[model samples]
Target: MPEPPPTADVSTALVTGGSAGLGQVIAATFADAGYRVVLVGRSSERLDAAKQQLDTQPGRDIVTLAGDVGVREDCDRIASTIEDQFGRLDVLVNCVGTSDRGLAGELTADRLHELIDQNVVTTLLCCQAFAPLLESSRGSIVNIGSLAGKVGARYLGGYNAAKHALAGLTQQLRLEWRDKGIHVALVSPGPIRRDDAGTRYRDRTDATLPASASAPGGGTKVKGLPAATVARAVLACAQKRRTDVILPGYLRLLIVLGNAFPRLGDWLLLKFTS
Candidate 1:
């Protein structure tokens, strides 16, 4: 058998929403690649399961933090835990998100607010609380955004708005923290896939999902991507400290053309995406 490559002793990570979906893949990818992982989520059982799944990897530290990023104190508490245990955080992946579907006049203001808190507030809280730790090692932050924010998805109105805000936040943080030795990056991917599909975009909040359910836009039945592919995209951006990245090829064009002429892009999107 061939020998595997060696990993660096400096590798350490804190992944929000790391119990499932893309966050799960991100955690596993880092673990398999030999980074000590701090998995954050709301459910202790789910966190334990995720830790167990990666237990086969030796020389890797796995810490499960069960808390809400949406709450300020919870974010502080999680940060303290990381400080107490690891003393320094080398990488931080923000995968906390929520989605609500309503078309035209059907979406409510409350739902809009929920989506904002999920996509914007939670990320801000996490980044703010971890700034000190990330600065200690000049680590990077990888925020998983959505391409829908680049264009528009009709029924995903609130979701698109929240993610749009996240894109802006990504840029603001990257620039403001650049001289502070903290690298910030955003990875805007299209609909991501997982082997065991679950309630991914069910509501406008990051509420507890059922044991099993369909993914957004009936994607559960569609032939879709593997979570590992998205994980690799994240890895590429982190290794290079790129400002931002878009996946699945098609989305990148949309990002370019959309920014160049947004109105024209909106017309095309409504015409075709519908």
Candidate 2:
């Protein structure tokens, strides 16, 4: 745990999925910057562990609420709790999402629903519940999206579709809430490396990777950006209120080229894999 800044001004920040991964890092970043952070997650045990880790800094307040953001009532509770306790929200970071790699043909209806509930519905409900508080404070929202949302991938059909919906939602919120003084932005990153990366993706049976995914790496040692890097980018997007941020920077060019020259973009994608 890092120490909060000595002279930093205080504010309130709510981070969903703050128990682990990128969300945890983002919550820590905000706490270090002197915000009273409220962490939301589904697992009480994990939330307790996260609270213990983040509550070390003196004078910095950290609260953890265990609830499913996919449920509307749970989201409402989160909003009410934050409102009664903090009165205002300066930041809202929506990071409660899951990923799955499966071909469209093999994906079951339940799996698709699960993906949507975990990713899109959670985001929608959280934002809807927190909007009034955010509006009161002229706060900012940072929605966690994915690189798959920008460009389609071979075996991530369901996850990609959900992320694409999130991207659209981010844009819609940005447009719809501009007059309300709420800043809305999206952070779309490439694959994030986790501590248990190998085991995390090992048990999946429904998806087969494209040759390109394993071209340079023989095994399942997929390369990815550090979660901390993505966390920093999330803060930057919130502070700057940028509409959309695509990670690695270079991916933006790929998106542009892909849109402008579809066949050439396909050739480039193939060339990279080959």
Clashing residue pairs in candidate 1, if any? none
- Candidate 2, residues 1-274, lDDT tens digits: the string is 9954432245888999999888998998888877888999989999999988877866657889889998999999989988876678889999988877656777888988989898989999999999999899888999999877876655564887889999999999899999999999999887787666545644563335654333211132225778888888988887778889988788799778987998877775554432
Q: Using lDDT, give the best candidate's number.
A: 2
Please give the lDDT score at residue 266 for candidate 2. 70
Candidate 2 residue pairs in backbone clash: none
TM-scores vs. true structure, each candidate: 0.84, 0.89
1-274, model 1: which lDDT tens digit per residue? 9845334444788899998778988888887776788999999999999888777667666779999999989999998877776677888999999765555366678878988998899999999999998998899999998776666665665777898899999999999999989999998776665543445445432233322223553232223556788898787777789878876766577658867998977775655443
Taken over the whole model, the C-alpha lDDT of each candidate is 0.77, 0.80
lDDT of 2: 0.80
Candidate 2: Cα lDDT at 236: 80
Question: Looking at model 2, how many pairs of residues clash?
Answer: 0
